[model samples]
Target chain A: MSLLKEFKVLAFLVVLVTGAVLVYAIGDFPDWGDPISPASEHVSSYYIENAIHDTAVPNIVTALLADYRGFDTMFETVVVFVAGIAVLFMLRRPKRESEVSMDVSGSPIVKTATRIMVPMMQLFALYIVAHGHHSPGGGFQGGVILGASLILMAIAFGLPSALKKISNKATVMLSALGVLIFSGIGILCMFLGGNFLDYSVLSAILPGTDRVMARSHAMLGVEIGVALTVMTAMFSIYADLASEGQLDQGL
Target chain B: MIWQFDIIILTLVIVSALSALRIRDLLGSAIIFGVYSFLMCLLWAGMGAVDVAFTEATVGAGISTVLILATVLHTKRRTKD
Candidate 1:
């Protein structure tokens, strides 16, 4: 059978099975917005009520990302760093006297669309990161958006051009800086009289009502670090793949 | 309405996983696996586990798929039976 025919069959099968399963599973699922699941009972409720007062951010997701479950965020940052290193190690090539550059020219419409969308996407990412304490989005979602914008750049102008704009060295450095900055905040907290990552200790250094603001500011700082590292790591991986012409080469 | 979404997502997950296994082409399998991850994300969201869903969408659907596709590109497109 031709590949097109095979794909059609696969699509039909997927739809049929999916429809059947949906009918079965819908009967068993909990009501949305119940506020009684493990999420509400275990950790989310606490974050919802106190996070704003404690962290001074309205976004529960942001509080979770930076404070309530910050240890996970730290490890996640490490994971991204490891991934970036792994990709670099796998794809690094010796510079030739003359390396071939791929043609990156695109139609006027595509170029204009990318140019308009890139900054808008980036701003949206920042908004998500900043408002995470009050809304559905946080560092991870925002970071992914940022990475996707970079991927869009690669798609529009080609890999080499994207790489030229955000070099591998720069991305690696940004990843390291993110980790270092995060750990540094913890260390600073330790110095001020709390355990590893106690944001409350930061209050002592500030005056009057500024203490609450200080803690929130500190959390935002760490969230930014997480976002930066994750975004760059993702972009680095895409760069590795594109450099190898992996998607197009069909191996 | 929410339960309906959950069921839809769960069904999507199962279908994608099964199709991924059945596909003859390695690239197609990788793409299906990505779709599976995405469905899993929706399932998590429907269950009100937004954080888990967010992580799954990013790591599972986004990065993992890209990595697998990259590996496939560097290797074979079909598995020998």
Candidate 2:
């Protein structure tokens, strides 16, 4: 059989199997938006109600990220930093005797479309990170989106252009800065006679009702930091892989 | 009817997994793996696991597929084993 025919057959079979599983599994599932589903009952509810009052953020996810489980966020940021460092270390080469220009040869249409999409993607990522305080998404999701935007730029324009926008040095610096900012918030809390990341004490430092807003603002700040670190780390890894043609060509 | 839908999705998952391992071309396998992830996301949604589905859609279908494709670009398309 032709490869295309085989592929089609395989695809059809896969679809059929997946449909079967869906039917069996969904029989036990609660109705969508039933609020009393296992997920809502298990954990998200506690965070949803108390998170707003305690953290002063309308977005439950953001509060969970920066306050309820701030320690996890810290470590998550560190993971990104480590991944960036690892990629840079592996891809590091002695200064080329002559700098090899990694230019892309692509159609004008593709290039134009990428140029249009890149900025829009970047904006969308920023929106996700910023609005995380009011919505379902938070740092990690937004960070991935941001990384994807850069990856798109690399595929369309060329690694060189993408590298110009996001250098290894810049990524490292930004990643470290993200960690620093996150830790700094913790330090600020400590200074206010609270444990690490104890945001309630932040109110003491601020004047009045502003305290709640300040704490929420602080949480948002950390979310941005996390987003920056993760996005860059993932982008760097993708860039390294693509630069070497790991997907299409031989390693 | 919904039960029928679930059964169909389950069948797709099984077949995709088997084909992913069976494919000779690494690129083709990676693409199929991506489709598998998408199917899994839909299944999760059907099972009322919206958060899991959302995560799967974004991380699995979105970033992971791209990352895998990048790795495929660096490596040979055909698997020798």
Candidate 3:
């Protein structure tokens, strides 16, 4: 172990040299707020200018993210789902070994605080998810908040209370459902004679709505699916890691 | 010339990060790192990148801190580093 101590200094020096090199190399890049930079002159301008017209979503980030580049977002959800599964596979104890003090809440005061705070957090998360078309938030941010609420419940009232509310089986199912909803929508669009995730073609299934309005509605649905997957993934990861796979005792 | 927010917040970030590095207790370092994350979130929000800031706030200050603290609780508290 002492031999490893000698390498710490070498590691620090390497990091310092790398930082200096990065600072020097950054001179080649354009300065902050440079108008003529490649990014500013590229597709971002098109996205900014045409996103609202094409998608009928006021939020450009939302439009570009959940609509124009929905395939990327769908895969990102899969990555989070994989992370949850990874934690479960790596640490979750066998069912027989998971029989410990699973229902012991932390303390009365903590429980009281969590009881009051959880609902508000959930409500706010819903607002963030629903209002994403007009605001800075979207599925990922809201889903994190929603998941945090469940994690808070676990911390305050023990893992059993949290798990009882939404069992591990449910989360596993839901994580898949979220990704399924996304890809399913894309597949449906394809079946309707449009490209994958081209929500404009979804008007056939929904009447009294034009193509733009259909796209707007479809974006919201995709965002909701994303939120569901993200929230469940976070919840599952927390449970698996905190309880060391037992799902019984956790902080 | 009112760089007051940036200067103060950046100073806080640097100070918190340094303290986190210096702290012998793993839990204390984790909490201080949370403070650093929060300050970095504020800096990102100030720069008008609200989405990035939101992610930083939720992931860095919120979930990662909690997860790391749980990891510390599972392991030893004190550190030679």
Candidate 4:
């Protein structure tokens, strides 16, 4: 047998053995529906119990994500921002004549469909971002949808057309603005005599708002920031990757 | 975790993942990967992780597939091997 075939055979055997071992190991895990599973018995119960009271948000996931774990989400947003900048820095190059594509825009039907649905898609994404406190969607998910709408625009109408709507400079600035909004909230909370990202103190800035209400409002702002960062970052990455740094004549 | 729904989606996810790995056409592989992502999204939602399922559907199925298709456009469609 050839070397490649031998390698594939060996890899297959290794995968089979690993799968068997993993399946066997599943026996050690807590029961599928057990309420007493270690995960549910600990910090999760605390979060579930206090989530609404603490953040005034009906969605426990959003409360935990943007309130109890705001610091972690802040850094995650920074990571995404950095990724966008990194892609731009690495992939951006001058377009060459030889690299010009056969043109993007798949067909007339696809283009017309995109033109019709892109607005609705973007509106839905915005709703997802804004309604995260009461719904299953959040910053990352909504931002991705928003970015995907832009990508769909790019794919259906060409990169240059999409770029006209959200140019490179605008993308970079918006990403930075998103990170700024996140950290700015944290710093303001600190200035108001609370711990970093302790949004309870935000009540001081907004008259007649209680701590819980303030926290909810702050969480919305934070989620919006995350959504902005993620949306711009994902779009930038797509632009660089699809255009191969030249940012023109892409599919 | 409803075993009924989970089991159905689980099989589809496995099938799509395997096919994605074995497919020769790069674009076909990307499409199969998107199918795998959608199946996994259903699995996640069935398991009561709606946010995760949404993320998987949007980022995994939607965005990742688009990027892969774009990459395939820029690169070779057929694998040499």
Candidate 5:
């Protein structure tokens, strides 16, 4: 007991010293919205000034994420896919004969309310994904919202009900499909004689569009791919966690 | 950001973070952590990063909270440490 007490005191002192050092270091940081700061003076300025001219996307964040740094976002989607697979491997158990389904359904009122809200939620998620080029949201956020709607269904009804809509096998397939969609677009760009993920070259295939519009359209396609992967992965993680990977009833 | 709103939200964020850490009940701790996440989202929105704020609200406050609650269902409600 005395040894444990001493360790706690030592930990607290270490934390204090670290905090003080970090606080002191913060003083050297540039002020908020400093135009001349290293971060804002370099690539940020380029993205801010030319994103619209290059990608025809009003939102610089979207252009930066889905166009300028598209390869990173594609790998990020793969990471989410891998994470879902890892959770499945770690926690998923084979269905057992002795397993029992738990009643997580709240009440009729809860069910009815969820039924009403789910459509609205799904619509809003779609809007977020579609409007991401002009607005604040994009694939990751929209996908999470979509996944949350499924989770809401699980909570109101039961895990079994939600599983019926998107089974375990479907989750894996859908997640993989998402990555495929993103990479497929990049491959198409390659086939069209452009560098991978270079959307401007896609204008050759997409009729009635110039280079800039083609980039914007290609970004939308990429965003959809990212959204698909993120939403399915999120739901798969929640389902595995809730059911202990049984895919049965969940709380 | 307005200084007053920033100060209040920052204080609440710190309080919620400390309480989430110090609470003995795992469920309460998870909920407090969600509150802290929501406050952080608000702070981000106030700082004019609406996109980041949106992500924080959805992933940090909403989905992560539900995920934690689901995990808590399988474990003991109280912490030993």
Candidate 6:
């Protein structure tokens, strides 16, 4: 047998065994939403009970993510930023002379529709970020939607036009700025006599609000940072990948 | 979660996932992967994890699919054994 065929056979056997083991493991999992499950019986209960009072955010998930676990979120943003930079480093290349020319315009119907939808999509993304403390959507989801809108614009009106709007330089800078914003907030909290990412201490510097409100405000700021990083990172990956790192063509 | 809806979505998720792996056309596989993502999103939503559902929808179903399709277009459309 060929080497490739042998390799495929081995891979398939491994996959089949792994799948069977996983299926067997699934039978031992706790029933759906079992309150006594280890996951629901410990820190989760504490978060659900006190998240709102502690962070003044109605969305417990947001509070848990942005305030209680701000350190993790900050690193997550950094990871996204790094991923964007990695793609740029690996794939980006100067435009080729022969590859410069292509059809740049799309059907008017699609262009017009995208034109109308893009702004609305952006606005909704903002809403998702801003209202995340009260709702289901948050920085990550909003950022992806925003990035998808940009990708859609690229698809409809062509890459060059989209690049004109959000240039590679801007994407890189914006993504870095996002990580900066996140860490910057943490640093500010430390400067205010608290641990890193401890927003309760921020109340000492702000004019009127108490510690709870401070945490709520800080969560929003962190969410914005996350949104910015995620959106730019998503767009950068797409632009780089779609254009084969040339940033001068579209598929 | 409703058992009926859960079972239906879980079935579709498995079907799409298996087909996505089996499909020889790279673009078709990518699109089927998106379908798998969407179904997973539905399952998350049904389980009341709206934030996860939203992320799965936007990142998994939307962006990853388009990215894969773009890559497929630039490369080979069909997989060779």
Fnat per candidate, as a fraction, reads 0.42, 0.35, 0.52, 0.81, 0.84, 0.81
Off by over 4 Å in 2: A1-45, A95-102, A205-212, A245-251, B1-4, B46-51
Where does candidate 6 clash, by residue pair?
A: none
Q: How many clashes in candidate 4?
A: 0
Query: Which of candidates 2 and 5 reaches a greater TM-score?
Result: 5
Question: Model 3 over residues A1-251: C-alpha lDDT tens digits?
Answer: 88788899899999999999998999999976677899889898899889888888988988988998999998998898899889888887776544556466778899899999999999999999998988888999999999999999999988887899999999999988988988899999999999999999999998888899889999888888989999999999889878778787776
Candidate 6 wrongly placed segments (more than 4 Å): A2-11, A98-100
| Predicted complexes: DockQ each | 0.33, 0.31, 0.72, 0.85, 0.91, 0.86
lDDT for A5 (candidate 6): 93
Q: Flag clash pairs in model 1.
A: A58-A133, A58-A134, A59-A133, A59-A134, A60-A133
- Per-residue alpha-carbon lDDT of candidate 3 for residues B1-81, written as tens digits (9 for 90 to 100): 138998999899889988999999999999999999999999888877788889889988998898898788888999976
The runs of at least 3 residues in candidate 3 whose Cα sits more than 4 Å from the true structure, single-residue gaps closed, are: A1-7, A95-103
lDDT values for all models: 0.77, 0.78, 0.89, 0.91, 0.94, 0.91
Model 6 chain A: ten consecutive residues of lowest lDDT: A97-106
Residue B78 lDDT (model 3): 94
What lDDT tens digits, residue by residue, belong to model 6 across residues A155-218? 9988999989998899889999989999999999888889999999999987898999999999
TM-score of candidate 6 chain A against the true chain A? 0.94
Clash count of each predicted structure: 5, 39, 2, 0, 0, 0
Which window of 10 residues has the lowest lDDT sum in candidate 5 chain A?
A96-105
Tens-digit lDDT track of model 2 for A125-160: 888788877866667778888888878777777676
Give model 5's clash tally. Answer: 0
Q: Which candidate has the highest TM-score of all?
A: 5
Which is the leading candidate under lDDT? 5
Worst 10 residues of 4 chain A by lDDT: A97-106
lDDT of 2 at A5: 93
Candidate 2: fnat, from 0 to 1? Answer: 0.35
